[model samples]
Target: MNRSAAEKEYEVNYYEIDYNEKLLITGLVNYFGDIATRHFENVGGSLTYSKEKGMAWVLYKWNIDINRYPKYGQKIKVRTNAYSFRKFYGYRTFEAFDEKDNIIARANSIWLLIDTNKRRILRIGEDMYKIFGLTKKDNKPLFIKKVKLPEKFSIEKSFNVRYSDIDTNRHVNNVKYIDWILETIPLDIILKYTIKHINITYEKEALYGEKIKIFTELKKQDEEGYISLHKIVDEKGKELSVIEAIWGIEEK
Candidate 1:
């Protein structure tokens, strides 16, 4: 029970930036995921170890807030901490800091440990707890604000999942949903605004070659900016994931 967090430094690269020179959402999430993996590996939780035990971690929910997107070539430090553990869930937090040490973004995520063989959630074991250096159990409820689907979607798009979309988990990677969510937004909105906040809840997995649909609704613009709600479903209309995003004009 010594170390529980890990940190890394990154410089934004051209490939990770969008047309406006701001880091893409996917790129930021990649950094967050990488640090989480590194932290676990540092604490004796390696992929080989998990595979040997037929165990893997899967994301359940995420809530991220950004003060501003990091620009291309900007150097920033990202850190992830394993703060708490419940029976079947792990609670982790992430923060990205600019060169000035200002926290540019913060995120909290929930993950579930799954038995790869049975493909069901597994309760946290004492050994796993020891690996993360966590001893105290968190009794307080961990919550993710519900993302309600709009009654009527203003826009809809469909895509067939591709092999490249699959991660080691054999399903669409969690970050791929962000691309699908953004695809439903209009070009004007994407060009005019930046994602300020995003909340996503995963309900089901999308497999390769499955036809999935995304429905989006743009709510009325308020002082903060625009809010968009999205729902992802399989061809049969089975809900897979729900997302809520807030977009705002970037402050110079």
Candidate 2:
């Protein structure tokens, strides 16, 4: 591995692996997030910087495609680069590779800068673009389109946001949204299947002690696997996010 400034290495530890002994989707999300945070810190735009500026970076959407699952104790490298930005949105790409240089996963995400005090979107300035060290060579993010859910949900559950879910931004971290969605899934389904693609759109922010409600429904199925739609909301019916995932059953 080149170990360039844009790349960071992480080992798949016991805690990050699931019952199947493979790195889980939530674990991969957390790794990409940590790498992105490192990039911010390297460019003097860390969480502290956002706080001092009375603003914070919020994840708006994400799409991940997994080719192979890295098993426990495998060392993986995460490569991330910020390519473009608009008024309030920034686009970044992430890739995970195994020790043999096999690409295990790829992801695209969109983020927004919001005023923490007023909770409004901030018009990203030219200087802010430079702060991310953008190359301006990347294409527009492909997964920005809205994710539509099924008309009726088959499963709905509620959970209390715990202290651990809060990140440095003082809000329910975006990664937890994936965790909650996975939790709502049945264990039998998880053990029998694997997810190859996931698309999530974050519409609202959840805070500590907030109650989150998750709703899921089977969208469709094929020989390979199935796709499920999920909606995350607060107790008051405010929609927090929507996620659509494509899963395939393990080969016999």
Candidate 3:
């Protein structure tokens, strides 16, 4: 069934904002992901289906573009839709809007439905696929998925996964991976440049209590923006997630 895109209204919570009183990038991502899950739950893609099928949805990668970051007390609406699937991959898109219906941010993500017990991608079944109104065609993204980072990097800092970082899935939430990456950048870089785009690939789950180091490198830059690469790794140096962030000063 072709369902209307799922939309939910929200107020930028005080706690979810940064020192600048604007919504944090991590917080925006959490809301975006929640909207996608909420869309699934509404259209017969219930938790019961997931459990009974022994399948769990895993995000493969995301490409997010930010136009304006809403500030505290701002009213916003998030819309999400699952569009297509092939093999083991599903495609979805989400958008965030301000009160005037102006777009604030948008993201395109790829996900995989996996057998939870087997820890491998599961060929999507008809019932589950039908619920998402899945098709073979792609929900093509607005921008090219071409963010690139250099091979070289520097060890920036380490963080311990605390209770706060774990989500309902008993793993470090995907948003925390973005947080970990942001934490490694210099304060000046973060303050001076607005994050216009971010590309992240989740490699492995970083469990609670694990200590992870953030390795970073400032990639090449030109008329578009500066690209920065980040790798979140465990104490033994095994990589957990890979991220590339594009930052630039807002145009006058």
Q: Which number leads on lDDT?
A: 1
Number of backbone clashes in candidate 2: 0
lDDT of 2 by residue, 144-223 (tens): 66788778998988999999999877789998888898887888778888889999998888999999899998755766
User: Per model, how many backbone clashes are there?
Assistant: 0, 0, 0
For residues 39-71, write the lDDT of model 1, one tens digit per residue. 989998898998999999999999999898899
> Model 3, which residues run further than 4 Å from truth?
135-147, 219-225
lDDT of 1: 0.90
Candidate 2's TM-score? 0.92
- Candidate 1 is scored at a TM of 0.96
Clash pairs detected, candidate 2:
none
> Positional deviation of 97 in candidate 2, in angstroms?
0.7
The C-alpha TM-scores of every prediction are 0.96, 0.92, 0.89
Candidate that would win on TM-score:
1
Model 1 CA deviation exceeding 4 Å by range? 138-141
